[model samples]
Every structure is written in C-alpha cells, then in structure tokens.
Target: MTRIIQLSDPHIVPEGTLCYGVVDTGKALQQAVATINRNLPLWGKVDMVIVTGDITDFGTAEEYARFRSIMADLALPVRVVPGNHDLRENMRTAFQDQDWMPESGGINWSAEFSDFGLICLDTLVEGHHHGELQPDALAFLSDTLKNLGSKPVVVGMHHPPFNTGIIPMDINNLRDSAELSKIIESHPAEVRLVCGHVHRSVTRSFGKAIGLIAPGTSHTVTIDQRVENPHTLSLEPGAFMMHEWRDDGIVSHIIAGNYSDERHPFTTPV
Candidate 1:
C-alpha cells in the first residue's frame, strides 16, 4: 500500500510575521507538524508528502525559507506545485533539488511510486487570484496521461476544477476547466483529482474521476451558502488529507485537529 499526506494552503510567512495581520500561520503550521509526527506511529508509513499550493501567504524568498525550516522536521520526501499566491521562479529555485521539477516552463511534473502515478499540473496565474490551464499546461497534461495510460493516477493542482459554492473562492477557481474534464473523461483508468485553494473540504465529480478539495492547514473559509461574498475566514481547526492507494482502489481520509471525547488517548489499552 502507498500512502500520501496532502497539506494545502499552509500560508507560512517569514519569522515573526503573520497572515493578514491576524492569522499566526507559522504557529498553525507548527501545531500541524506536531500532530502529524504524533500520529505517525498509528499511520505506520507514508510514502511521500505533497503540498497542493499556497505554500506561503506571499510568494517571498523569506517566506519560502521559513516554509522549508518548518517542513524540515517531517523527515520525508516532499513535493509541491505552484498556487495563485506563489511565484514560479521563487518556487522553482526554492525546490531546485527536486529533479522531477522542470528547470523551465510551468511547474507540471509526474512521478511514479509503486503502481500509482502522481501527476501535478501547474494552475498558477501570477499576480492574479484566478487560475487557468493554458495551452502549454493542457498539452503537458494530455501527454502525461497518455504516457501513463491504464495506471491509476492522482492529479494534483492548486485550484479546484468545479465550483465550490463559496462565491469568493469560486470566482477564483480554475478557468477553462472543461478542457481538463475532457481529458480526464478520455482517460481509461480511474483517476482521482486532489486539489487545494478552497481552504475547506469539498467533493465533486470531474468526468469519470472524483475531485477532492483538501482543507487548509492554517485556517478555513466560512461556508455561507447564502452570502454573496464568502471572503470571511474562520478560526476553525486546521486539517489535512491522507490518500491511501491500495490494489483495490484509492481511499481519502480528511484528518482534522478536532476529535471527540472517545478519541482521547488512555494510559491503558481498553
């Protein structure tokens, strides 16, 4: 079995800095890291760790440095993609050692672990909050899927391919998504599309595949279906997603900091 931990929208800033002058993203990430380490014994093994996007509140060299510092404790292989809040060159330079990443062009990449393929598409539109899959990115996706035919794939991107109901976020969702859907529809094997940017967990269907939005590690957007603007952030518990790939199929579990009274640890095993 292959397991992957998906962390999204961490929004890590430079030391002593915060996001929006309110969120202590750095502290939030530290807590998240601790939780992951604490639960490692129970989860057994994790093949790799992938951060969908928005690695920093601002795409700065300092922020990336801070991000690397915090993530260094994971002690596992890590992969990443660019989000709307990210700058291509900075991200590429920050993770230059990742041989899978291309030196030029979009940050799209593909890697195989066991029988599963991890395909990451770059959906970043620098200087803009909305995302788009340009011709080049589309071609890359087509080629990657064609080459990996018949193998189950996990597609990672920064923006969701479907509307998330949160008006503020939906306004910045992936553009030209129909083209992406067509490609997924043409694929033979089962594909799972996992993404960030919604900052909340939401599920939808993408052609024959399932589109999953992982919650943010720092904070989450308030879910107000009736409101015209869904820009408000909440102090809700942080969370992440774990995707388990087995011979039968892929199962996704959303793990949050919140657990009920029955979930508390005991000194003696019952």
Candidate 2:
C-alpha cells in the first residue's frame, strides 16, 4: 500500500515573528512534524509527503529557509507546489535541488506509483490572491494526464476548483476551471483533486471527480457562511492529511497536529 502525507498552509514567517501577530506558525509546524513522526509507526510506511501550498506567509527568503528548516526533520521525501503567498522565483530557488522543482516556468510536475499517479499543478498568479491555470500549465496537465492512461490519480494544486460557501475564499478560487473540469471528466479512471488555500477541510464535487481541500498547519479560515461576514482567521488546532492507496481506492484521513493525552482503549463489562 502506498501512502502520502499532505501538509498545507504552514505560512511560515521569519524567526521571532508571529503570523498576523497571533499564531506561532513556526511552532505549530514543529508540532505537526513531531506529531507525524511520532505516529509513523502506527501508519506503517509512508511513500512521500506533499505540501499542497502556502508554505510561507510573506514569500521571503527567510520564510522559505525557515520552512525548510522545520521540514528537515520529516522522515519521508517531500514535494511541493507554490501557493498565492509563495513567490515562484523564491520557491524555485529554494527547492531547485529537488527534482520536482521546475527550473523555469510554472512549478508543475508529476509522480507515478505502481497503484496510482500524482500530478501537481501550479495555480499561483503573482501579486494576486486569486488562482488561475495559464495556457502552459493547462498544456502540461493535458499531456501528463494523457500519458498516465486511465489509472487512479490524485491531482494536487494550491487553489480549489470548487467553492466551500466561504464567500471570501470562494471569490479567490481557481478561475476559468471549465477546461480543467473537461480534462478531468475525460479521464477513464478515478481522479481525485486535492488542494489547499482555504485553511479548512472541505470536500466538494468537481465535475465528475471528487475535490478535497486540506486544513492549515497553523490556523483556519473562520467557517462563517454568512456573505456579509468579513474574512477572519481562527486559532484552530493544526492538522494534516494522510492519503493511502487502498485496494478499492484512495482513502484520505485527517490527523491532528497534537494530542493532549495518550491513547485509551475502550472499557468492557466484566
């Protein structure tokens, strides 16, 4: 069985600084890393760790360095895509050594496993909060999916193609996704779309495929559904996702960043 860990929206800031003058994102990510490493024995072998996006809060060199420093302790291989908060050039320079980092153009790539394939696309539009897939990226997705040939696959991106009733975030969703939807609908096998940006776990149907949005590693976008409510962030417990390839299909589990106590077994009548 192949398993992949998804860590999203860490939003790392420079040392000694707190994100939005509240959440200690650095510490939050540390806890998340410790949590995953501590629980690895229970999950067995994890193939790779994928950080969907929003790695840094300000997309600075210092932030990227800090992000890497925190992630260094992870025991599994790592792959990443850029989010709105990420500066593509800075991210490219930071992960240039990694094979998945593209030397030029968008930070798009793919990985193939025996059971399924993983394709990560770049949806970052610099100097803007909203996301879009340019012509080149669309071409890449088209070619990659064509080559994968009808096996179950997970398409990872920074922006979700569907809305989650959060008006603030819904407005920034992947715009002009009609072509993207058409592409996925044409796939012969199951196609799962996994994304991050909203800082909350949301599931929705995107065309013929399932769309999943992961929670943040530090904070969450407040879940008020009222259209008039202003956008806000909450100090919610951090979490990550575990995507495993099961015999039937891929199963995703959300794991919290920390626990208050040790596990307890159920009591039985004597």
Candidate 3:
C-alpha cells in the first residue's frame, strides 16, 4: 500500500517574519512537520509528501530557503507544484537539483508508484492571482495519462477547477477548465484531482473525477459564503491530508495539526 501526505499553502516568509503581518506561517509549518513526523508510525510507511502549492508568500529566495529549512525536519521526501503566489523561476531554482524539477518550460512532471501514478501540473500565471493550465501543461497531462494506462492516478495542481461558494476565491480559481475536465473524464482509470489554492477543504465532482481542495498549513481563507464577502484569512487550526492507495481506490483522511495527547478507547464513550 502506498500512502502520500499532502500539505498545502504554508505561505512561508523569511526568518522571524510573519505572513500578512498576522500569520506566523513559518512557525505553523514547523508545527505541522513535527505533527506529521510524530504520527508517522501510526500512518505506516508513507511513500512521500506532496505540497500542493504556495510554499512562500512573496516567492523570495530567503522565503524559499526558510521553507526548505522547516521542511527539512519532515521524515519524508517531498514534491511540489507552483501556486499563484510562487514565482515559477524562483521555485525552479530552489529545487533545481531535484530530479522532478523541469529544466525548462512549465513545471509539469509525473511519478509512477507501485499501485498508482501521480502527476503534478503547474497552473501559475505570473503576475496574476488566477490560474490557467497552459497548452504545454495540458499536453503533458494527456501524454502522461495515456502512458499510465489503466492505473488510478492523482493529479495535483494549485487551483481548483471548480468554484467554491467563497466568492473572492472562486473568482481566482482555475480559468477555462473545460479542456481539463474533458481530459480527466476521458481517462479510462480513476482520476482524482487534488488542489490547494483556496486554503479550505472542499470536495466536489469535476466531470468523472473527484476534486479535493486541501486546507492550508497555517491560516485558512475565511469561510464566508456570501456573494460579496470581504477577502480575509482566519487563524483556524492547521491540517494536512493523507491519501492511501487501497484495494478499491484511493482513500483520503485529514490529520489535524493541533490535538490533545490523551486518547480514550471508543468503548469508553458516554
């Protein structure tokens, strides 16, 4: 069984600096790393950790360095795609030594696991908050899925192709996703779409694929569902996701960062 952990939207800033002068994103990410490492034994042999996006708030070299430093404590390997807040070239330079880092063009890559396949696509449109799967990324998805054959696959991107009720965030979602939907719908095997831009856990169906949006590692985007609500962030508890390849298909679970140490048997419930 292959299990993959998903952490998203840490928005790490430089050392001693807080994101948006409010969220201590770097520290929050440290806590998340510690939590995951502490619970690894219970989770059992996680294959890898995938950060959906927004590794740095300003996409600076110092911020990337700090993000790397915090993640170094994690007892697992990690892969990432680019989010709107991330500068593509900067991110590429930071992880250039990694095998998955593409030398040129969009940061599109794929990995083949024992039971399934994983594909990460870059949807970053520089200088823009919204996301778009450019022609190159679309082509990469098509070719990679064709090669994977009947294996169930998880596709990771920074932006959700579908809109959530949060109006501000919804407006910045992945644009022109019809082609993307068509590709996933045409695939023979199961295709699960995992994303991270909105900083909220949202599950929706896109064509035949199940789309899951992971919550952030630090602060969360406010949950107001009004059509004209103010864009904001909340100091909600952080969390990450674990996706395991079971006999039937992939099963995803949310692991909270903050929890009490005490445990009680289910039979002891009032």
Candidate 4:
C-alpha cells in the first residue's frame, strides 16, 4: 500500500492574533498535530506527507521558518504548493530544498513515490484568494497524466475546484474548472484529487473520479443550509488526511487532535 499524509490550511500565525479573525490558531493547530499522530491507523505504513498550502498566516519568510520548526517532529517526506496567503519568493527562500517547487516563480511540481504520482499544482493567482489553473498549468497536468497514465495519481492543491454554494467561497473557485473536470473524468486511471483551503471535509464527483477537501488544522467554516451569505469562522479540531493506496484502490482517512475523551498517560484520576 502507498501511504500519503496530507496537512493543509495550517494557517500558522506569526506571534500574535489569528489571521483575519478571532480563532485560536496556535492552540488548535497543536491539538491537530496530536490528533493525527494518535489517531492514524496503521501508522507504520505512512510513506509520504503532502502539505497542500496556506502553510503560514501570511506569506512571510519568518512564518515559514517557524512552520518548519513546528513540523520538525514529523520526520517524514513532505512537499508543498503555495496558497493564496503565500508569497512565492519568500516560500522559495525559506524552503529551498523542496525540489518539487517550480522554477520560473510558479511553484507547481510533480513527484513520484512508490510507483504512484503526486502532482502539486500552483493555485495562487498573486492577488486573489480564489485559484485558477492557467494555460501552462493545465498543459502541465495533461502532459503529466498522458505520460504516466497507469500510475495511481494523487493531486493536491490549496483551492477546491468545485462550487459548494457557499456564496463567498464558490465565488473563489478554480476558474476553468469545467474543462478541468472533463479532463479528470476522461481519465479512469487517476485515483483521487485532494485539496484544502475550504477548512472542511467534503467529497465531490469529478466525472469518474473523486475530489476530496481535507479539513484545516487551524480553523473551520461552518455549514449552513440557509447559507445565503454563508461565511463563518469557528474553532474546529485540527485535522490531516491519510491516504493508503493498494491494488484495490485508495483508502483515505482524516485524523484530528480533538478526541473528546481519550485519556493521556499523564492524566490521573483528576
């Protein structure tokens, strides 16, 4: 089985208040890490870790450094793409060894692990929180899929390519998503397309394939059935996704830190 761990929308803040709101990002994220480490089933099989984007509160160099420091304990292989909140120059400067990072200032990349392909897309459009794959990126994806047709493929990004009717969020979806969906639908060989930035867990159909939105490690956006202007910020447990790929298919799980009643070793009868 091929194991892929996904950590997204961490929104690691600098040294003060939360990003754009009133969430306890630092504390929530800490809980998220603990949750993943403890809840992951078959932990020994985890092979690769992919961080979709929004690694920092802002696209600052120092924030990346702090983010890296916080991730030091994972000791697993990881790759990243930029989010709307990220800066390409600063990200490159801080994470120079991430070979998958695109040259030419794009930061998109494709990688291989255990005979499976991991495609990281650059969705940051410089000045917008909404993401769209440009012509070059679309071409890159088509070519990559054509060349590695039979491999189990996992694509990660910072934006959901579909509309969820959450007025504020859907307005910021991937621009040419219909075309992209058709491309993915025609390819039955692909396993899954995973993304972040929505701060929620959802599954949508893309032709014959599945698109997954992993939860954020920092905060969450509530779901409202009457969501006309539906934009809300609330504290949810931090979460990360674990995907295990075998001959049967890809089995995925989301692990988080907020276990309501799991007793820690240090917790006595108190």
lDDT of each: 0.88, 0.92, 0.91, 0.77
Q: Alpha carbon lDDT of residue 116, candidate 3? A: 85
Least accurate stretch of 10 residues (summed lDDT) in model 4? 33-42
Clashing pairs in 3: none
Candidate 2 residues 1-270, lDDT tens each? 878999999999999999999999999999999998888898899889999899999899999999999999997899999999999999999998897888899999999988788999999999999999999888988889999997889999999988889999999989999999998988899988999999989998898888999999999999999979699999989998999888879899998988754976798757
Candidate 4 residue lDDT tens string, 1-270: 678888888877775766776866666666665655655553766677778888887888778887777776565776788888888788888878766665575777887767578778888887888998877777777788877778778888888888776667777877778777766665658558999888888899766768899988877877653657648876766677888776767878887646764556865675
Q: Using alpha carbons, what is the TM-score of model 3?
A: 0.97
Which runs in model 2 stand beyond 4 Å of their true positions? none
**Relative to the unseen true structure, what is the Cα RMSD of model 3?**
1.3
Model 1: lDDT equals: 0.88
lDDT of 4 at 22: 80
Which is the leading candidate under lDDT? 2
Each prediction's TM-score versus the true structure: 0.93, 0.98, 0.97, 0.88
TM-score of 4: 0.88
Model 3: how far residue 151 lies from native, Å: 0.4
